[model samples]
Target: MPVPLIWLIAALALAGAEVLTGDLFLLMLSGGALAAAASSWLLALPVWVDGLVFLLVSVLLLVGVRPAIKRRMQSGKGLLDPAKALEGKSALVLDRVARHEGQVKLDGEIWTARPHVETDVYEAGDQVTVVHIDGATAVVAKIV
Candidate 1:
């Protein structure tokens, strides 16, 4: 069997493994295998030279390019959950809310609420801004 054919098979196997893993490391190794294949089949290089080409390309990709790929993949903020959607949104007070107790209608649904500032109170029909969410409750402040 040709040395290039062996490299080609190894490349294909590594590429398939890369698909399953989702990490770029295996893909870099597959790229190295492809370089070895090219060196053997295209350049007709000796076995030692082809092995060296593979090792160089694979190490370069792993050390030089992998971190940038991982960083780009992780740069974006993750999708917001429904509760996070209410952050800084205005809501209507459904019941009088004091230091530690209140109710408000947010996005057409009633949620347990509390004044963000202990000294502030929200009366029924008052508008409040949801500052944050604490488990099942909305921490709100009187809309200025």
Candidate 2:
């Protein structure tokens, strides 16, 4: 019945949904709602002010804090291994790579591959290096 209690309940529900979905968005809203509940309790704010505070805090947490957290989590993770370095990592061609058909290989295990250039075709059993990975396919250049 009380505004503070309603905000608290909404916050808990959002947090519970976040746990179930494993998405970070709901958690941000939960934080905002909790802030609103606190404001309601501390200042005895009107319902509209509580709602406004919730919206502002939710946007701030999602847009500001979420990105910072994501950056910290992703930081220091390079796209490629330093040892492999895209220069000389060996791969075996498992399929004929045409301009559009692409290639396949066992890069540790079987993987779909694509040649770097349409002009550079490769047959099965051809040794290649992993120049880059594009989506599900490995873009390869001919070895030797």
Candidate 3:
């Protein structure tokens, strides 16, 4: 059996496992196997070189690509709770805002607002950054 054929079989098996796992990790390994097979067939590289290529490609995909892929896959989830998603948003103060009192337009809706710092005061039209959300109120700080 040709080495490339063996690599192709491994790639197929890994990809099949990926289908069951749905986590993309096995898919990355499948990609590495495919590359190894291609290198073996096209370059006619030595066995050690083909194995090295497979290992290097797999490591690269796992370390560099996997995290970004996971982030892209996870983005915009957990919408049922707004706390983690709403933090760090910018808002426009629509009313005088001080400790425990104010209103701001956040995400196209007005929300009760308060300064994150007790001494901070924000006037109408001030741009503020949402630091935290306490129940229905947004804690804001003036944008530097």
Candidate 4:
């Protein structure tokens, strides 16, 4: 096979592996292979020169480009943990919830609860919204 055709095949293989791994590292390598193919076919470069071009492109993309691209793709795309998902969810106070301690029924489970604010309080049977979780406690505010 021609040198360029070999490079193209390597690029395709790397790209396919990247899809299965879901990591950008192989994708960057595939980019380098594509560059090598271009150098071989378009520039008609020697094998050694094409190899050098591939190395430079791959290293540059892996170090400089991949991180920024990953960050952009991940922005606002974090998966919520189950506990964090409880924020803003409604709950029923099982005991008078004071700043220090109490109990509430949240997501069909009993959980330690507390008022969101120091002066805030919730009597038993009160409806509340979980503001956030602090350690093992759910900080909550009155529903209305």
Candidate 5:
């Protein structure tokens, strides 16, 4: 069989395994194999070069793309909880935010906010960093 055909067969097998495993890992490898098949068809590269390409593409997908895909799949809603996702994000104080109570415009929506530290306070228009989500409130620290 041709090199490209072999790679395509490998990709098909990987995809089938992915279906059975229900994990995206094999899907990523399948994507790499597909890429290798394309390279082999277009460039007629040597077997060793095709192998290197497969490895590089597979590693990139596994390391860089898999986490985001997995997170989306696992979150069910396609995203993490808003509060958890907003951790460490910047917000603009819309009201005097003290340790007890206040409001801030976080990612365009107003949220009940509190200072992360007892002494920290934020006046309207000040920038703050979201420290964490405490119940429905955002615990924030001044950006300094």
Candidate 6:
């Protein structure tokens, strides 16, 4: 029946839902609920005030602190790139890429590739650059 207990329960429930759905929103709300519960216990605030505090704190944590923490932890590196990645670099066509089937060699590995433009055709040993990646196929363009 205590406000803190209720808030704690709500927080736990929100966190559990986040785990299930994998959405960041509910997880932020959970942090807010926990903050409200803490405010209730530490400040001995009324139930309504506790609820308001939870809302405020949750919003602050989700909007303000969470992004800062995420940025701080970020290494500016993508998950797929190990050494030089296929995002903004160049590669060479090892074999002629036909209408729907082609292969390229990049970073010493042969990868299935495709031309970005539908009409563009590439020949073997031509210099190509990785433009974009679609699933297993890397979209490539002729490097001048």
Question: Residue 97 deviation, candidate 3, in Å?
Answer: 44
What tens-digit string does per-residue lDDT give for candidate 2 at 1-144?
A: 989999999999999999987658999999999999999999997999999999999999999998888778679666665434543567877778767775565436676777787688888888988777666667788877
TM-score winner between candidates 4 and 6: 4
After superposing all C-alphas onto the true structure, candidate 5 shows an RMSD in angstroms of: 10.8
Root-mean-square deviation per candidate: 3.9, 5.8, 8.9, 5.5, 10.8, 5.2
For each candidate, give its TM-score against the true structure: 0.63, 0.52, 0.53, 0.57, 0.53, 0.50
Q: Compose the digit string of candidate 5's lDDT tens values, residues 21-95.
A: 987999999999999999999999899999998999999999999999988878786556867889999999999
Clashing pairs in 4: none
Query: What's the residue-level lDDT of 32 in candidate 1?
Result: 98
Model 5, residue 53: C-alpha shift (Å): 0.5
Model 6 ranges off by over 4 Å: 21-23, 70-75, 81-144
| The 10-residue segment with the lowest total lDDT in model 1 | 76-85
List, in order, the clash count of every candidate structure.
0, 0, 0, 0, 0, 1
Off by over 4 Å in 4: 78-144
Per-residue lDDT of candidate 3, residues 57-134 (tens digit) = 998999999899999988855545677578999999999999878999999999999999999999999999999999
Most accurate candidate by TM-score: 1
User: Candidate 6 lDDT, tens digit per residue, 94-139?
Assistant: 8887669899988778889989897889999888888888887888
In the range 79-143, model 1's lDDT, one tens digit per residue, is 88878899999999999999778899999999999888889988999999999999999999977
Ranking according to TM-score, highest score first: 1, 4, 3, 5, 2, 6
Q: Would you give me the overall lDDT of model 4?
A: 0.94
Query: In model 2, what lDDT does residue 35 have?
Result: 96
The regions of model 5 sitting more than 4 angstroms off are: 77-144
Error of 2 at 26 (Å): 0.6
lDDT values for all models? 0.93, 0.82, 0.93, 0.94, 0.92, 0.84
TM-score of predicted structure 3: 0.53
